[model samples]
Target: MLTIWGRRTSSNVQALMWCVGELALEFQRHDVGHRFGGLNTDGFRKLNPNGTIPVIQDGERPPLWETGPILRYLASAYGEDDFWPRDPTRQAEVDKWAEWAKINVAMAFTVPVFWRVVRTPEAEHDHHAIEKALTALESTLAIADAQLSEHAFLCGSCLTLADIQLGHVLYRYYDIDISRTSLPNLRRYYDTLTERPAYQTHVMISYDELRRN
Candidate 1:
């Protein structure tokens, strides 16, 4: 069995969890980081010197950190090349979308939304920052909407690693209260994602608590 260290609420951890369920791989998960707070301890550091959540120990192999790397490793090792692409060009395309989500979409939209709803105190919340993030996010989503109009999934016909990576972030965006932007294609794609049992079980959650605090 594999051992994973991270709290359930962490988005990175959620990505790993969703992957495990999608692959039907059995594993053990330990709650750490954030309110759980074992990340800084020496015992935890030995596994992951950076003290980040979602580190995985695969049998006797050294533990792996960083959510995207972990996802790629898992797909390569156990996903029968279905989660990831085997063809060089297809792989490159998947990698591009995954990287795009991390840098462009995640940084500009997801982080700010998460911070505003989950981390920031209500009294001190930065409305301007939130609005700016929302604007940037809406614009970026328009691109995704157009892309999705041509294909059912991010990297092509099938649900590849790119979908998994972007879907995790989309969960956050879908939950956030934003304007009525014309994103019919993105909306349809998101609806399809929710219909999957794996997504419903692992990724879907109420934003009420995150918003309330």
Candidate 2:
């Protein structure tokens, strides 16, 4: 059986768990980050020296860290043709969007927008910085909106690994109490993603536990 180590609330961990759900792979998940804390243990360090959550151990193979690579490995090893695709060009297209989502959209939104607004105390919150970050995020999301306008999913009409990586951030983007530009295509894509049982189960987790109230 495959084993995953991470808290359920982590976005990265959720991405992996969502991929596992989509692949219908049997796996056991253990809470090990955030408030869970078992990362510094010697046993845990043997699996991942960096002590990052979301390390996956498959059978006797070495544990894998990093959400993107872990997801790619799962899709390649266990997923059907449609999930990861076989054609080099098609796979490249999928990879492009996954990187964009992680580097552009996810990174843009999390720290500058989400952490500042949700995790920071109201008195300490930097509203100006938040606005600036949101402006940048809105610009970044525009590219996704443009792509989604032409295709049902990030890579195509069917859901792919790109969607799994990208879609996880939408719940936080929309659910967070932040002002956002009207992104009709992105919203439609997110709404469509939410219909999937895997996405709902993994990506749509509440962040109320992470909030600073």
Candidate 3:
């Protein structure tokens, strides 16, 4: 069984777990980071000196840290053709979007929008900064919306690793309090993801603990 170390409430962890669930991979997960706080231990540090969550050990081959690499490792090992295409060109096509989502969409939303709105205390919220970040984030979402309009998923008609990279962000994006520009196709795409059991199980979770922190 695959062993994972990360807190469930963590967005990165949620993404990894969702992909594992979608692939029907048997795995055991340990809650760490955030309120759980196992990040600083000597053992955890040996596993990952970077001290980040969502690290995985696949039967002692080695511990893998960083959400992106761990995810690609899983996709390469377990994902089916539609999920992770074998052709280099096709793979690159999907990978580009996955990278794009990671760099552009996820990065833009997490610290900029989500952290600002949810993690910060309400009275101290930076309205100008939040608005600026949200506007930037929405511009990127518009690109996804246009692509989703033509295809059911991010990279194509069927779900791919790109979807795993991008889709996990939508739960917090839609649920959070913010002024959002209407993107019907993006909304439809997210709604479709909600119907997936993996998406619902791993991504749609309570942030009450996060709020209390």
Q: Candidate 2's residue-wise lDDT over 116-198, tens digit each?
A: 99888888989899999999999989999999999999988788999887899899889987888999999999899889999
Per-residue alpha-carbon lDDT of candidate 1 for residues 4-92, written as tens digits (9 for 90 to 100):
99988777787788888888888999999866799999999998899888999889899999988998999888875546878888788
Candidate 3, 1-213: lDDT as tens digits: 899999999999999999999999999999999888989999999999999988999997899999999999999999998999999999999999999999999999999999988998898899999999999999999999999989999988899999999999999999988999999999999999999999999999998787723
TM-scores of all candidate predictions against the true structure: 0.92, 0.97, 0.98
Total clashes for model 3: 0
Model 2 C-alpha RMSD vs. true structure (Å) is: 0.9
On lDDT, who's better, 2 or 3?
A: 3
Stretches of candidate 2 exceeding 4 Å from the true structure = none
Top-TM-score candidate index? 3
**lDDT (CA) per prediction:** 0.81, 0.90, 0.94
* Worst ten in a row by lDDT for model 2: 79-88
Instruction: Find the 10 residues in a row with the least total lDDT in model 3.
Output: 204-213
Over 4 Å off, model 3:
none
Q: Highest lDDT among the candidates is held by which one?
A: 3
Q: Considering TM-score, where higher is better, how would the candidates rank from best to worst?
A: 3, 2, 1
Error of 2 at 105 (Å): 1.0
